[model samples]
Target: PHQKTVIDVEKDILYQNDMLAQRNRGYFDAKNVLAINLVSSPGSGKTSLLERTLTDLKGEMEFAVIEGDQQTTNDADRIHATGTKATQINTGKGCHLDADMVANALKGLKPKENSVLFIENVGNLVCPAMFDLGEKERVVIISVTEGDDKPLKYPDMFHSSTLCIINKTDLLPYVPFDIEKVKLNAKRINHQLEIIELSCTSGEGLPLWYSWLKSKVLAPEPV
Candidate 1:
């Protein structure tokens, strides 16, 4: 009876997740919103990357963010500092951000044109890889400080991502992360991965990333 109950609960969660995903996706379709879900482990610089992006192109895009964290509104606070409307979703014990969390958070925001919605999922490389939050694109960020072999160890995240960013290149010298090895391993898992190696602190490689992002957000989906 206990096993049956557990199974039923899991099934319900999945059903709810699916329904929310469809709804959120439909919302984006109607508004022509280009949403991106950014996933990575803690300290992977997901928020920092978004900060840099916002600073550079806030004038061009009506940018907003859905900041997911297990606790606290710290990340949302940072994003709000940039003058972008950011909604914080505290997932209590949840390790990942699901579609419902995003849908719920979207309630209070004012809609805008050609909006770029960046959902910064809770810092966990595993669970976030499993849940699709109705994003048009998914971006995975891995920092050099996290080690070079993360791609091999966490293939699911790397494989599912449309864009892979290698952050903290400014700290590459201080750390023993082999940039070449990281690329090779990541490509092994996802040969088609679009990688942007950049350091937010030094502004290194930002131009390439900036251009790539502008093109991507503006790129229309093929029918």
Candidate 2:
């Protein structure tokens, strides 16, 4: 009886979140906003990538950001420094940003039509995978310092993400990580997962990332 109750509670919680996620998806579709959820473990360079993207693409496209963290507003502050609109959501004891939190944040963000909205989820590979923030794309980022077996260890995250970014490639010479092995592992989890290897510090492979973003934004809406 106890196990059944726990499972029921979990299902109910997920059901509620899924309904709200559908609403969020509708909102984004109505506004033609391309919302992308950035997920990763701590120190994975998600913020660095966002800073670079915002700085390099400034003036070309309007962007808004929602920074999610368990404690401080540091990430939001960094995003704001780039002159882009950003709102911070401190989850406190919560591990992930749920659809309701994002729904509330969207009220203040008011991302422009046809603009890109980046929701930087809390640096967690586990809990965040289960929450859908109504994003058009979910990107998983991993740094070279992290082990190549991350995809296999965090299969849920790898299975859920649409794209996997291999960041901090500049440290490849110093780290023991294997790029090909990581790609294979990620592919094993999700064969359709698009992989992009880049070094935010060195600007390597950034253009490809930029092009991918452009392609998504420029793609015609589905009928």
Candidate 3:
């Protein structure tokens, strides 16, 4: 009897996804749009960071967002409230956003040339790590309320991400999260992982985050 193993099917799925991702990359390159994929566990302040970013940089640079969630357009509504163009993809039972999904969303978003395109992926660290959406950078957000051992627990996510944002710094005084420990653990998994600490509530460390985004937008080709 003919049979296919789970690994075989998984490999085929990833290969197909990667191919589509490359096509998305080519499109972004031709359009001169800087796309960033933001992945994180739920309630990690990904939406808050984006809201503040869009509000702060509204006049300085044009930005658009593609929000992925299991259901509801709540996050996209928040982004729209900040006056940024946004498209929402309701993944239903899907755990993560794939390149094909982003490609479809881009059609409706119609992102402007030379603008920043942020993809707020579904709030799951594991699945998103396996799907590259042809973004210039993959950013993982972890709030201070979460354990420092998260990087160790989710090595694949940390390893695949280009940058990690340690958010909710204002809660550090109340929470037991250790920034140094988180950094050490993440670095052990990914030596080249760039990290930034910020508090979206109080605006601390936000300038550095904004600077990082600006740099990426200026470069746009993955530096």
Candidate 4:
């Protein structure tokens, strides 16, 4: 009885979140915004990648950010330093950013039409996968230092993400991580997953990432 009750409550919570997510999607569509949710474990270089992306693309497009963290507003501060609009959402005990939190953030962010909105979810591979923040793309990042079996270990995140980024490739020589093995593992979990390997510090393979972003934003919407 206890297990059934807990399961029922979980389902109800997810149902509510999904409904809110739909509303967020509508808002993004109405504003012509491409929202991307960045998810990964701590130290996966998500922030670094965002910093590089914002700095490099600042003149090309407008950007807004919602930085999620369990504590400080450090990530949001970094984003604001780039001259982009950003708002911080401190989740406190929460491990993920839910749709409702994002909806509230949007009011404060007010991202311009035809702009990109990056929601940097709290660094956790598990919980973030279950919540739908109404993002157009869910990108899961894994640093080479975190090992090659991340997708196998956290199948839910890998299965849910649209893109898998292999970051910190500059350390590939020193680390025991296998790029091919990780790609294989990720493909096994989600064959449709698009993969990108890049090093933020060395600036290798970043152009492809930038091109991918532009293509997605520029792609015509389905009628």
Q: Report the number of clashing residue pairs per model.
A: 0, 0, 0, 0
Q: Model 4 over residues 50-138: C-alpha lDDT tens digits?
A: 99999999889888999999999899989988888999999999999999999999998899888999999999999999999999999
Q: What's each prediction's TM-score?
A: 0.92, 0.97, 0.95, 0.97
| Per-residue lDDT of candidate 1, residues 1-223 (tens digit) | 9999999998898788888888998898777788899999998899999898898887877888999999999999999999998888999999999998888887776445468899999999998887889998899999989999999999999999998899999998799999999999999999999898999889899898888778866544555
TM-score of 2: 0.97
Name the weakest run of 10 consecutive residues (lDDT summed) in model 4: 214-223
What's the lDDT for all of these models? 0.88, 0.95, 0.93, 0.94
Q: lDDT at 87 for candidate 4? A: 97
Q: For candidate 2, lDDT tens digit of each residue in 104-179?
A: 9999889988899999999999999998889999999999999999999999999999999999999999999999
Better by TM-score, candidate 3 or 1: 3
**1-116, model 3: which lDDT tens digit per residue?**
13567778889999999999999999999889989999999989989999999999988888999999999999999999999999999999999999999999999999988888
Which candidate leads in lDDT? 2
Candidate 3 Cα lDDT to native: 0.93
Q: Indicate the residue-level lDDT of 111 in model 1.
A: 43
Higher-lDDT candidate of 1 and 3: 3
